[model samples]
Target: MQIFKKFSQLSIFYSEYVSFPYPHATTVKKAHKCTINHCLLHSHLVSSHASHKFVSSGGKPAGGEGDGAGAEMVGPQRPQFVLFGSSIVQLSYANGGWGAILSDVYARKADIVLRGYYGWNSRRAVQVLHQVFPKDAATQPSLVIVYFGGNDSMGPHSSGLGPHVPLPEYIEHMRSIAVHLQSLSDTTRVIFLSCPPVNEAKVREGVSGIFSELVRTNELCRQYSEACIELCQEVGVKVVDLWTAFQKRDDWLTACFTDGVHLSAEGSEIVVEEILKVLKGAEWEPSLHWKSMLTEFGDDSPYDLVAFDGKTTLNPSDWTFHRAIQWD
Candidate 1:
């Protein structure tokens, strides 16, 4: 059985650079440089090598192929969750990004693969699908979340534009992505996230540079987001309709987005909530509690016991249990 944590859209709010063809030293170094927190980069590094038998949940190479390995029985293959799309996906690992929050919550249970490229649209995403996700079973992810349309939905007239993908082409690209993912593994799932609604007032008033002119309007975003929902429905894929969900709340402009386009902390929280709902629908069981791992507990219980080294014994009673759950 695999444990998968919900992927957060918040990781896309900030900008970061990741080199092509993973497991490269230079890629990790550049990631560390762009990230606000080094810990996030470290977490990513650990996730990258998660497929190996020796890699531990902590991201370090532990155990070996030879003697005295009895105590080090291989752990269940950890689930991998991939984030694919534009800068929003890249920035999702930022301090307040959704990807960072997801990494914290799903820490030991799963690995969050960051494949977001800044300024990329559905067209560009299609070109790198094989590189990001291979046909190999070991590299297959439990869930692949595609977050696009922000750039694709940009008004055709916007000046100094980004790689604008037309709506019909965008829909086909999304469908193609789903088809390709299905080809990879039958068990793996795909979730399509609708483009977020942009606040034209905020962009015009506060946002600077090419982004100010290039950002799409709320109306245009709605069109694209609606199309995403339809495509997902037609293709039998799950969808997180952020465009509709965000506007349902009053003053969502200030509540959800940092600028007119990016997400604020509160906005990221909303995205997580929506994603969790989709996970629940897919019947993802929540993680076990600390108290359930106590020595006094019975083996008949459904929950997993606290994992520890065979060389060291842990007293569950010694641990402090808290009900408060916080994600930042």
Candidate 2:
């Protein structure tokens, strides 16, 4: 009852008031907002535990017996699918961010781990890969999606010259990442999302003052996108050519981008579609919908119980959510 109430409250909060801010906004501001939201969610989780009186396997009150002892088996652990990149990826959880869409589609199928940073380039990404994807199998992801190059393609003379990772170095960094990911798990698939084209005209026209003078142009972004495609090809990984995809559309500037850099909801939809295509090609499908387990009003039988920890039980009360329910 406590868990149900907690989820119900969260659901109401998100449906009524939650909204991720624009991606191109300052990182400090965005992060501050997210921090507040996280703190609230963490408090909710903690409070839920206090109210949840777990029943042990022997039908005894958990931690309510002698010595305040109790057994806790935090249910299942699902396959992890991680997204690693810069602000573009980081903003995916925003209203129109592709990452958010992916999270919705894969709600119970996989745990979507977001490792997106505000201004990270492939160089910075490479440095953090090991920390994000530890060698431990338990922590390693089943799928890794890498989206970078927006910051890497910035002109050397731009506001922060240090962010510009050279073309050759960019390509190499991508290659190294692919190799490292493959080494972690043979089954782990990697996909690279090439940078989308930037509209310099739009940026200069006072659309987004943040990147108005940033040295990133459509031409420069094209080069990085091509390099990403080539690197993926050479490494036998999948590549999504977002640059080409956006350019093929008319009025991409207004339709795809909120700012000159971050994607709008329309752009996010396109990204979600492209990623789904790749997933389909690999024969990936959504996990069984949770609703399937619900009994109808006239139903006389209970749903079969299954455990993610490789165990089977007839009691639905025994199921806990340690991990997510994954697609078969």
Candidate 3:
């Protein structure tokens, strides 16, 4: 499902040298790209015998037959949860990051897709909102976790070399991000993480040797966090106020961050907890919590378990336990 939306975006992304049409077809169009569009119900996929070289539209062969054995197109397999945000999210997979934790917790239940971009603020996120979460996705994600504001809250650099977006624009960008995700599908839930606090004593400016001032502070984070929560409340979207949450910890300043800006293992744990709190409390029809989602193939095959008697030898049929819960 996620791959379905990456078509044009990836094409544009690799437009420099590589180009292709069908995601499954053994075809290509370089300097170039595309000639086949497939639907899910089709019996066979696209291929090209004449122009496997990718000179023309080597669409699906007639009567479900292609030059070679038809490649099976990837079908919908599991629910997807996307983490979309700035640097915090980009680094969420390293050093016991929250995203990595979520992946571990949700194993076999769903796919947690990371769409983080470092050094990005609300303004940068707004520009790629459509590309990341296109309105025309064949299947929208079951959930999207959004975090953008910390960078935007940075004090405007004297030479305008920082990622400081005005307060008003930040609000609007966040609002748009939420609205777009909501519009993806009625069940496509969004959880926005507000700006987290920074250790004033440890944070510094002149990042990338580009700026020459103190451009980040807890005070600014507070304002952005407040605005984020207010906007979420107004639009009925779920929000995690990281600014207040971070400060609640007694050792937040020293224990929670690697450099007073990024989160450490302990801090990332808080994010995981807060997110679980929302997921557990929300009234989404099929819950996304690990416990709520049944395991994929149920328990081990009956053969793998201790058999006290001949009746316990169910073997392959015992795997049916996983089918107890249905997506609908």
Candidate 4:
């Protein structure tokens, strides 16, 4: 299917394969030092409609189906969940990146739509909120995991040019985003990830290589994180307190972050745990947990291992991923 035109305009590079050139580094520390692989392969170049022809409820082809053409109720639509935020979200598919982890867990449960922009902050996020979560969406995302404020909480560069959004404005922007996402659909749910703490030493060590004149301090990040938590509590939105969670781990300072800011694989694991905890504990109806969700398509009944008896007795084995047959 053709991607929404507006969404196409926003995303220049869609999806890609990730492979690192670590040269068989032996130590975990050496692997951590390896640069993040960016061998991006654009997966959206091919049109989804090239193979299948979807017709509207009116029996017309999908392109110009016009009104009331809600596919499935109008072609088949898969359940969708969105991950929207800044670099933390954009680079999620990286090796062991948190977004990649969620994609793996929810592989057959739901489609994970990634909407991340590198170096973007709450200020910029608010400006493009509509395009990301359009009002005319045929089906809204069941869940949206939001991450921002890391850049927003930065100590402004001396040149006065950066993604630093004032704390009060940041809070308001986040609140607005939450409201807009919640308003998208009654089924839409939002989870905010508070900004995580940064290692001041590492930020000074390597951040300049990425963004000269960039400044970040744990103190600043903590304040922003506190603000996000407070905002989530006030608005009755679910949140993953990344700042506190990272701190709770004894090795977070050295283990959780790759360059004092971005998440390391270890850090991403923490994110996965936190997000799963929220999904399992939230009071949302019709839970979206991978274990709880029914896999798409029916069971692999045809592949079930049958007994080699001459008689046609039905003896299925679990080796073929066939759950116990319910005798209704």
Candidate 5:
């Protein structure tokens, strides 16, 4: 009952923020709006521990239906999938951005478990995975989605340029992940999303010398995508080329991203739609119940909360506090 009350409060808070306009038109202003939205969403889920219930309740709500049913449902329940990677997945909570969209679209189709960290590199990600998901002989996921490598390529390398790890080394790190996931379960499908492109102009203008480094990083992303495809084929892992999808659709750039680095709510939706396409093509059965939940709860996506007011001054106080717990 407390959880339900908390959930109701969450719904109310999200509704308020979703309806509020950004106080300003600058990137920081928009980010502040998104940050408030995210904090509220995450507070609801994490504070009330609803996500844990969702994970451990055997595909049933805590006190929902099926209590009096004599016979178990005949059809298969929702499939459980895990998402592991970087800021993209982490950013989903604020606006249900891409992850929320994917969850809504695929909810009754698949139960997605998201494990993402902001500013995490492949090396750190690998460590996090081990800590979070100590592979068990019996408990393995049906699908694993990995979206990383952007930070690794843009780092504080001694040269202050190029990939933190060379292309070959990056490929090996990815390979290790794939192999480990496979070892967990024969049926576990792994889908690795390619990192999207950075805006050259934004980079050059925003951070001096970072633009050239980002260009090189984007190039590596291209190369890495190609290599990942080959590596997956060789090792029998599924791959989703988000970079190519972004390239084909200009709207992915114009609609989704606030800056070259991060995706707006609209942009995240595009990414989710593209990912759904891949899942459907693979004939994966997503969870309809979860999809319904998303549709019901995520109808007011961040895109709908766009600010049109012409305020120019960006105010930091409007956003929720963000202390980067870890970096690099």
Candidate 6:
């Protein structure tokens, strides 16, 4: 039954991508360039793609026309790509864990920077944006990927977190970020990755009542992710549903997580795989063996034993567990 269900879903995904038109390669290339420009800008939120130079309206009038009326009007130019965020951008390097893998896969295919932090939240992300991207440089990125809300959902600040970042405030921040980028380049695309699920077991074992806190935190993260999607939609920004994709995989628990919070090497690979699928305009395909494995284990119960190459194995690490925290 599980095999049938898994195959059915894979069929649907394969069909969807196969039927849907692939985004133009040229367009994707252009978007990559734009993303680079935005990353270089750091925090100023200015558009690097702006072609027209703004002249001072206070200058003396030419002929009988007023100074403003005689001002030259510059036409729009081709769109560009931009990058934005926090330490995640830096994390794209080899030392940056999962981000490095993503960087290598997407390298040249798109211009992306991992502007994530070791421990940062939305507020901190905003601060980094302010510091890194200057007003003029902010506009070039055609595609912006946001991997945030994780740290925000945890830590001391968690108590003050809310369902939404106050609609008005959220809009204002998004507007400030988007308007500048749009002004620099009219066709920038912004994508926000929803926060992944927390390891409740780790919370139960490590900190008292923290597991419950994580549940509440995950819920809030979901809300924020939804809010971000809606906000992007309102302003014509593209959004990628990373949380849902991660949730669908069976290995997240065993292969990816190291301590129920951070991703292990294998776990990061799963994330990169999904990102690649999206960038390539592909869909998720659950392996037949993976589905069968899930059926054997059942939901909410850990796999006590694993089988490999015609032999039973006691070590869970031998198998590739999808979308769950690793025990070791």
For each candidate in the order shown, give its overall lDDT on alpha carbons: 0.64, 0.64, 0.70, 0.69, 0.55, 0.43
Model 2 over residues 1-328: C-alpha lDDT tens digits? Answer: 1111122233212221212121111111111222232233311111212222222233433334532243232235566778998998888898657887666565544667898899898898898878887778575677889998988998885455568999999999989888998889666778889999977776666535554455668788989999999888889988889998888889888889886778898898888777776776664333222222221121111232222222221232312221121111
Which is the winner by TM-score between candidate 2 and candidate 3? 3
TM-score of 4: 0.70
The 10-residue segment of model 2 with minimum total lDDT is 22-31
Q: How far is candidate 6 from the true structure (C-alpha RMSD, Å)?
A: 22.8
Error of 2 at 102 (Å): 0.8
Model 3 bad stretches (over 4 Å): 1-75, 205-211, 303-328
Question: Candidate 6: where is the Cα deviation over 4 Å?
Answer: 1-98, 106-112, 128-130, 155-175, 204-216, 282-328
Against the true structure, what is each candidate's TM-score? 0.65, 0.63, 0.69, 0.70, 0.59, 0.48
Pairs that collide, model 3: 21-34
User: What is the TM-score of candidate 6?
Assistant: 0.48
User: What alpha-carbon RMSD in Å does predicted model 3 have with respect to the real structure?
Assistant: 17.6
lDDT of 6 at 78: 18
- Better-scoring candidate (lDDT), 1 or 4: 4
Error of 3 at 263 (Å): 0.7
Q: Is candidate 2 or candidate 3 better by lDDT?
A: 3
Instruction: Put down candidate 5 lDDT per residue, 101-145, tens digits, no spaces.
Output: 555444344666889888677777666566666676346677788
Please state the error at residue 4 of candidate 5 in Å.
Answer: 28
Candidate 5 Cα misplacement greater than 4 A, ranges: 1-78, 108-110, 159-163, 208-217, 283-328
lDDT of 3 by residue, 1-328 (tens): 0012112212121122221211233322222223223421111122422122111233433334443224232236678899999999999999989998887776666789999999899999989999999999888899999999989998997787778999999999998988889999888989999999988776763243654775788889999999999999999999897887888899899888888899898899888888888888888878876567644443322223223222221112112112211111
Q: Candidate 6: lDDT of 122?
A: 57
Tell me each candidate's RMSD, in Å, in order.
14.0, 12.9, 17.6, 14.8, 14.7, 22.8
Between prediction 2 and prediction 4, the one with superior TM-score is 4
- Quote the positional error of residue 254 for candidate 5 in Å: 2.8
* Model 4 weakest lDDT span, ten residues long: 319-328
Runs off by more than 4 Å, candidate 2: 1-75, 158-160, 205-213, 283-328
